[model samples]
Target: MHRLIAALVFLFCATVRVFPHADKVEDRLVMHFATGGHPPSNGRWEDINHRHLAEVKGTPTLTNIGPAVALQFNGYTDHMLVPIKPEDLPVTAISLAAWVIVNETMADGGIISYAQDNGPQEKGFALGFDERSFTFSLATEKADDGDGKLTRIRANTPLTAGKWHYVVGTYDGETMKLFVNGREEATSKEQGGKILYPAKGRFTIGAYIDDNEFHAMDGALYEAKVYGRAMVATEIQAAARQNRALLDHESSINKELKFVVAPYLQFGTRDSMTIMCETSAEAQMLVEYAERQPLVSRTRSEEARLINTVTLSGLKPHTQYFYRVTCTDKNGNVARSDILTLQTAPGPETPWAFGIIGDTQRNPEVTKRATDGIFALRPNMTIHCGDVVDDGFAKHQWVSDLFAPSATLFSHVPLFPVIGNHEKNAHWYYDYFHLPKPEYYYTFTYGNAQFFMIDSNKDLSPGSEQYRWLEAELRKSKATWKFTCHHHPCFSSDENDYGDRWKGKAPEGFRSGDENAQRLVELYEKYRVDVAFAGHIHSYERAWPILQMQVNQKNGVRYIVSGGGGGGLEQAAPQRAWFTVHVQRGHHYCYAAVHDRTIQFKAYDLEGRLFDTFELTKGR
Candidate 1:
């Protein structure tokens, strides 16, 4: 009984000590418009009861659309505007936040927009979402430019399945940021002009003009606020958590993208480049704010490897550009070292070549052999299509198999590494190398084809998230050859055991089966996934042009299991009919030659003698 009482007392004390930001003051204010019996017509009042307004829910019943109050609009000309007199007006930096549910995209001709009195474009910003996909669009216009600048942030998933979400925009002198559900989604500093004037115009909740098509907000809205001072990321994150509990209790929420993919395209005229890196963690948790921001103006996070990313601006594309990483130690010491160079992707006329390797396990010496061969060939870049290391993230395994032998070669050539089952155990792959998201799956476009890397070991089931992502990525591709690489071979020789190893024990959230492999095969048949590669069988087995296990001859995906890089030999068992091609048990590497018209593959033994060759002719 005494121990229980002491535990309760300890819990109370711990709760009291739990404030992470007690020192910093939060500049926040909230206002609610309570309408009596009748809904006010004038634009002065921001109505809190959306059901009466008819913005979202109907007259008979109010659909509790989470954060928003249903509003109604009668074809009136003037719009609704709420009085927002900040305690400290004209504060240099500030944040404007609100919750909105748009049942439809912004009306075209009526022009129900968000505007302020500062400048024409500075008037206000407008947000629209396409109903079918819930694609969001935010536009800012200036009178001088005549036409408004529109930026769209498409949600990977739809929002209007009756869900309430948070949207916040912040202006910090030079940079303008847009956040969705309290997570920063996009940013732009390329505006030619400044914010016309102080945020003096009346704060408008819905509709620019009175009773415009966009009036009274067709959807529901809940908590709204505007701060005179720029709220740090911690404040926003905490609010997001609270909002999730208060408003959206039963909706599927995704963690925000860690960082945006900074544009890689550059030209002779551009002097500097700005790369946007994202982080799911709050800025306060970052270890080195300077290294994370790098732009000199922002001092946000203090964590190393925070999602908030490093930006490299002022770059000359096509020219050799060198950069160094800036991180910090536990003591907050700035550690900026290891200068690296990136010779940006060549211009339209330049022809480039990259090599491909798969499954360099069993023998660490295989990395040396493959690197030596690839180096001799003088390929501009190299891609390891998964299974780089043998087992899970054992630190020593990486040293012995990956970095040691291939370090020299990789340092010279731009090497793209994918997540293999072996590389997933420790999550050390991202620490050693800086690839894109470091997720088990990702996509990148190369010279003529686009490459997709998937984590087959974890989840490859039909209708799974990875499968959906693959379909979306494949659909968005402009490349003629959509090449996919994973650690587990989708198709392999019956000789060496091939198929799903973790067939029954996939994680709870993941789908079961090599369904992804077969489904991918079907998708390849439909969308023309030119070549698929895998490494796990420890042998070199190539598939003939096949669709649903039948010979399509012309338009089918060819699977290559090149697991014999340095791994132990596993001979391919003989299989008849359209399913089998030449299966070799020799210790060899594979090379692909891609041209505008045709792509050719040659499997060569360690002695540099070609054993098997195949070609893919392009369509008219």
Candidate 2:
């Protein structure tokens, strides 16, 4: 009888050990810009095919010159602007992509402008770049009302050097988005007002109406594509990650980057399976690199060593799992690899919680300290509201400011990051994280809430397709709570930012600059959104339930600015009619708890002492 019991126990242990095989998720798509690409049939603006100086005609050829004619640039370096007639093409969603090697950096960096004209100066929209960093921006105005304003959504990354890099700008009336390579790095919005033009003239590129002489492009331009519809995030990433197909298993033997998926994997189990690793290099040399790792679980095979890869499965859906990479080449050699982590989707059945962090660009040490604090609190997941690394486009700074300091915690946490104005490389943010949407704006769910992670640093207007999508999402959500997080603060107390203040100084719905700010605030109020958070100002603040200045606690949504994840120090605003509570200035990390009845928030300094706290009740 005792022997029989032991056998049964062993069988039970083996059953529990069975692992699940992983189903592969399709890779995100990235659209590449070769030269002379064709626009959608609706494209009518300055077609790259009909250049005034030289015809760049072609039918979306991979190269610049072709027979079908793909895109057209104004080439009006001498002050001549390209004009587009509405009859030529009417578009609700548009994205512009190109590969450029700048001839020289601008002395002060002025506008390298792209404008939609309604006859010379009647009214229209304009996008430009700052003189200092080749950062992109947007400016719009109504020629008749003069009520339009400029919304500058600066790219977080830099446009420097003579290297080839992909750049894309997308405008869906409601949201302006910018992508580098294939990753979204910035987003912004214009309120309800139009940067309306008289529509009498043509669209222009490179030179503005204000220029004295028509200046032609000084740099090489390649692969410019304009799409009439908003490009899906997944489609964009897949294109970006596409590489020349290497020789298959049946082909050559000289390849070095080939990776093999392991066998005996269960669909949803924690069993770590071994992957047989071998290279063209001698087995002994490969073994030398393997034995150095401590976490690598391996065994000797006939041709190579079988090392286990950490399998993150059977987790509480939508949670961050911390892990490390370990491997063995041959000869019983082992080495410890870098620690890494991933966030699992919420179990197909329920919702979860996550935190937000942003702009740790100024003071990395403080950011590091805050990161430790956030990890200690243990959120199901986290979000960096852009600018986690200053000079984000710069490779070295990204390592020091973001990766190095945050690695310890990041390895254990799953972070869903949004594009900030600081990331510039087409692949700057992509090479770092495994995001659900390779592009900048994405949507995810947790518990009773649906979160909209958007880009507020580029030009997305309200009437655009992005806005239409947002409306559809809000309408479809059955979740009890709705939250949105982005970088720039819509209404903040940064006294230096005159744009945030509205006291008769500016009309309520008037050109307060970036009407999207005003429009978003209005939408949140209308939809009964529970909370909205933002970070650009580098301080911690909370607004009272307010709509058009009248305290509508019952219906008003709450707005919080918690950008103080250790960037440049900033002061907060004092008590105001619209402010329920606030922490104008502090060096702290934000904490949140999603519970049955309400969503609670608190701010903590590096020492773990609570500096600010508030409770937001939830319900119909």
Q: What tens-digit string does per-residue lDDT give for candidate 2 at 301-413?
A: 33432222223323444543333332323221223223344445454245345656777875768888988888888776677777767776676666567766775566555
Which candidate tops lDDT? 1
Q: Which lDDT values do the candidates have, in the order given? A: 0.51, 0.49
10 residues in a row with least lDDT, candidate 1: 260-269
- Model 1 over residues 1-620: C-alpha lDDT tens digits? 34533443344233222222321444543333322212333223333422113232112111222222223221122234544343323335545665554433433311123443223333344333444432222333222355344443444444553345666666565455666676766666544233333234334444443222233343434434455445567777776776564345442212222211111111111232222222233322211112221222222234554333443444444455544333322222222223344455443344556667777864767678877787667565677767777775575676667656665556445666666666654566665545556456777766567888877766666678888888888888888678888877776654425322334233433221134466677667777888888776676778777777776788767888777667677764444424568788777777776666577778877777888988778886
Candidate 2 regions with alpha-carbon error over 4 angstroms: 1-322, 327-335, 338-353, 499-515, 573-577
lDDT of 1 at 415: 64
